[model samples]
Target: EEWMALRIGPVVNLPINHLAELSSKLDPDFPVVAVCNSAYRSSLAVGILQRQGFQNVASLAGGSQAWIDAGLPVYGTETQATVSAAPQRHVHLAERISAADLSRLMQDLPGTFDLVDIRPPQAFAEYALPGSRNAEIADLLSNPGYLTGAGPLVIVDRDGSLAMMIAGILSQKTQRPIKALQGGLD
Candidate 1:
């Protein structure tokens, strides 16, 4: 029999991919302790948070596994509802559209599809392709019904990772044709 992984304690679980939303959700000076099964992603998260102007941030030296190994307090039960707060990895393969193809499609068939840009509002305001609409990942995931459009929905991001993950999740949840921009807008 396999056992589910347990959380260390009551911690604000945030996915590293959605760090863009952190600024809006957390104060820049809020103390943050990033943790994971291993310390690799935690360290990365700490660096990203620091770059985003987060004043006090740190990563667990060896992560939750280490904490468990040290016999630290933990709380969870099989009956406890599993939290789906963290973004799931792209299990379903999402279709990718090359930039050239996307450009051609935009020019050749206007209104045929919706280009949803999932980048931060500031970045989108700074620069975005024509005919693209800004959207939050949370909205896209929660209210997928709004995705109804003429054709396939194309997701765009700064580096395509989040877009790919979103596309995969959406593909599993909706009947709409989904695609992520290959290599992102970077």
Candidate 2:
């Protein structure tokens, strides 16, 4: 891919959701190569960054998979992480818990599960479930152990898609049960 072949030295791992908070920290004129497992999301990120006044941002044409396929180097194993093919995995019923079931589970099993609200703090503050705790996706990615030994860690988000993907990524990192809210709280 033309984009991947450019060989940027450092990679800044940014989730699409955290763009607003971190955008101020990024130099708008600096060259940036946004990447994902597939290029679709990264391509969209290019537009978002551009709209936010980023001047030289571009998306990897085929994303990290293509970069890996072409034998390009990936850096910072400790902080920068990637899911090989998370979405393609077969999702089991237990991987997503319904809101109703989650309610009952909390009632019946009390502290058997940890509810993690991945939405932004303002949204979470406005309306979040009784026991859910607010967290950014970056935090969970940086510390997979946070999801460890917490009964089943239940990730809650606005739509659940991001939550589900995060659950998939964290599941690969830890043996703990990671779940997303089914259909989310929408």
Best by lDDT: 1
Winner by TM-score: 2
Model 2 residue 137 CA deviation (Å) reads 0.7
* Alpha-carbon runs more than 4 Å astray in model 2: 1-94
**Across residues 1-186, which tens digit of lDDT does each residue of candidate 1 receive?**
101356777776677788757655888867888888888888999888888889899999998789889999976644556888879775545699999999999999998888899999999999999999999999988985745766999999999999999999888875667999999999
TM-score for each model: 0.50, 0.51
Cα lDDT tens digits for candidate 2, 3-118: 34443346666778877667778899889888877798889888888888998988988877898788877653342466665465544333988988899988999888788999
Instruction: Tell me the number of clashing residue pairs for each predicted model.
Output: 0, 0
Clashing pairs in 1: none
